[model samples]
Target: MPSQEALSAQVGAVYTTSTGAPVAEPYAAQRVGLTGPLLLQDFHHIDLLAHFDRERIPERVVHAKGSGAHGVIKVTHDITDLTVASLFSKVGNEAPLTIRFSTVGGESGSADTARDPRGFAIKIKTDEGNLDWVFNNTPVFFIRDPAKFPHFIHTQKRDPQTHLKDADMFWDYLSQNPESIHQVMILFSDRGTPDGYYMHGYSGHTFKFVNKDGKFHYVQIHLRREGGAKSLDNDTAQRLAGENPDYATEQLFTEIEAGKFPTWNVFVQTMTAEQAESFRYNILDLTKVWPHKEFPLRPVGQIILNKNVQNYFAEIEQAAFSPSHLVPGIEPSADPVLQSRLFSYPDTHRHRLGVNYGQLPVNAPLAPVSNFQRDGAMAFNNQGFRPNYQSSLAPLQYKRKAYEDVKHEIWLGDANVDLSYVTELDFEQPRALYEKVFSDTDREHLIYNLSVHLGNVKSPIVKARQLSVFAAVSKDLGDRLAKAINHPSVEPLAVKPATEAIRYKLKAA
Candidate 1:
């Protein structure tokens, strides 16, 4: 290998500090003598050491490990009737996008093939502003209530005492919270370990698309792989986890690098407010999914990941996404989880990235940004000489859209908040999934997967509670799970009491 000087000379490139100060002796540090202590005046050496020490930013509390790529979202279908967002103003409208695929409940060094939901976050640079769709590989989540979020995440993480993944701790929380059975079933299935990152992505949260007329439709977004979705069996996933932990990340990068761009067809299942009222399950329920039969998927467009990130740290790692990053016409629903996320996502970004995280190139919107925010740790764009408050002397022009002034929906009910109770309705979908959706082989795999993890749980009480929850979903599923785990018998349990009892009911006025 050529020396630094030789390489620089051959390339005719000057070596400089971050501030562009040319450095002649790039390799040597100034010192008192050949073997003496380093001089404090050696700013270059000190700067290098200081920068190296602060090189790492705070990793995300969740979805710490991820892979990302540059892409484009091409609007193939006209949805102007549905949403007034300019991202889909006309057919063939294409917007540049950045997508991050990640494993939830994992540290930065964790294996990519872990049996965890993949965070499918996309930042679409639209003409109006940046619209972020922070989705997941699965259509449903473990819990619907936002209050249970931290507790549920804690269960997924290491136990406080042991500082290790504790099966007893994991199942104890899930067993007590039976509403999680739906997502739990999906988690333990073959779908848990996806075939690399080539899996379907779902919004999970129901949103709204408001038109110019102020009419709105509740929507659920889905991203289906162009070919089809694929999954790996437990053995294969485990093998890859040990052999090559970065298998999924490598596959995505190499595929894009080879010019074999993976495409996902976007679709939405929409329902009117009137329809939502009569729907079997609450639209706000995160654990439940709208039946495709009732609300069919309408084609939207295609997302083609054509380019790979040149620098992971700068381009991908620094990129921030939030469910609240909505443009006009696209609005969040009343789902408690989604509602909570609107605040939490940006708050987490502020804490993890910085107060001025939005100023980062990857996160900054395509549209010109004019805001009152100024002066933080890293305020790249401080809007110099501009007043931070509204002023008649130099008034900022604000373009008000149709939806901006429209009062689309109104809530006239008493404020009532509590953890959602587990009812028979909670188990209906999971039962259907096991009985109707899963093939014989899929069922076998599901049973095996559940057995592998749940079997490790040493507490018989926790194991029995979870089995009962399964039995409630389906007697066959519960029996199979029990037999696989070598348990004696399985009995369906009544609806378990939630962490907190319903304190108040929503009474319509």
Candidate 2:
């Protein structure tokens, strides 16, 4: 046998597969003849193909295309009075965080510059536990009820019959459900197609924040990009969609690699229980927003992305987040969408990952875990020979923390009904957004944007119906859209079909 040093040097010169078989040539596959089919006997080729076949896991239902980076969330201001969440306990404290930015409806292969709301999700690993603030770039969403979520998303996707994106499907759904107007207005505006991942705001739909002494307040988290929001025009975004579909993803990764780390200032808008009750619009409604005049943002911390994942699938795809994974100082509110998501998120992870998905290194909590649950598929870290149950003889002890120790407010409401309804207040924000918030230039761009998409609808009825909703928001908005689409005298349609007599009377000389 060779000496130890000589043996090590010889071993280091050879390359092998996971099974320790030396790979003679990695470039070519073994074949029967020059142009013949590959040989199955070649284990290397078989292994490569087998791994490639299963390379793709299930893509997310929404926010499918995204980019993620590792960062540090540093508390700049002391909010210990508001919450005892370790990440925000004191100034100068920092925690490891990972953030993902994405287009809400696009696929993994879709254009990065598409005109859509960006998903701004952050996962903070604190000493207490992991806290996830899965937010969106837009402060409000398209619908208030979780039941409508599937339907609304379907409209954004390709039509089932044609397998192509349908303008009629998009407009018809929004026309039928007026609650989508606020998001629709924002989507048509210039801000829809952000310049890149670095430019946008993040909003946590449900209020969730807690302080020391068990006091809690309904809070909305905000992440304002240090560079401020920027966007490409329709022409530029469309051109880039054809030329470079992954422009935004490449931009983010390259910037970070070049040492230009992106940062955002985190803030929160807080509301007391009485304030939530006396609000003009339902605070629980995800489609609406609490005006800044009443609830101003309070600065708390900053987040800076300093590292990139070495492997996309292992770090980004396998990383799981859920609203229900709250730490001691945080809790969920009565927001219906959020309440539904509390269950849906973990359920999705179980489906996509294995039953014991949390055991994965990416999703695992830093804190120790002890529970009665045991024995599922892919149980990599199954406690060896330990009784996976509560027992007296085993000397396993349980500590019960006081409910009051965690920050949460008790609500007294009937839990029997599935509360879902569209109210007149649904249109308030959208109307004000169109009239007061958007400037003349923004309004002009909105009209141009709406006309570009709406003009493509083949059905005149669908076009008229959608225009009527626009008219309901504002007569000028309706008139402008109608004019842009070459229908100058478009009238608002009735909620129900009009009778022949009613139509005749209205049209009478």
The candidate that wins on lDDT is: 1
After aligning candidate 1 to the native by TM-score, how far in Å is the CA of 156 from where it should be?
0.7
The pairs that clash in candidate 1 are: none
Model 1 ranges with Cα > 4 A deviation: 1-10, 404-418, 496-509
Query: Can you write out model 1's per-residue Cα lDDT over 1-509, one digit (the tens) per residue?
Result: 22345557669678888889999988899988799999999889999999999998889899999999999999999999999998888999999999999999989989999999999999999989999999999999988778888998999999998899999989999999888888888989999999988799999988999998888899999999988988999999999999999999999998987789999999999998888765766677788899999999999999999988867888899999999999998999877788899999899988889899999999988898887877999987898898898989999998887764433334311122444566666788998999999999999999999999999999989999999989988889889889999997778977543222232223222
Query: What is the alpha-carbon lDDT of model 2 when measured against the actual structure?
Result: 0.78
Q: Kindly give the stretch of ten consecutive residues in candidate 1 with the minimal lDDT sum.
A: 500-509
Q: Quote the lDDT for 31 in model 2.
A: 95
Could you tell me the TM-score of candidate 1? 0.94
- Quantify all predictions' global Cα lDDT against the true fold: 0.87, 0.78
lDDT of 1 at 82: 93
lDDT of 1: 0.87
Maximum-TM-score candidate: 1
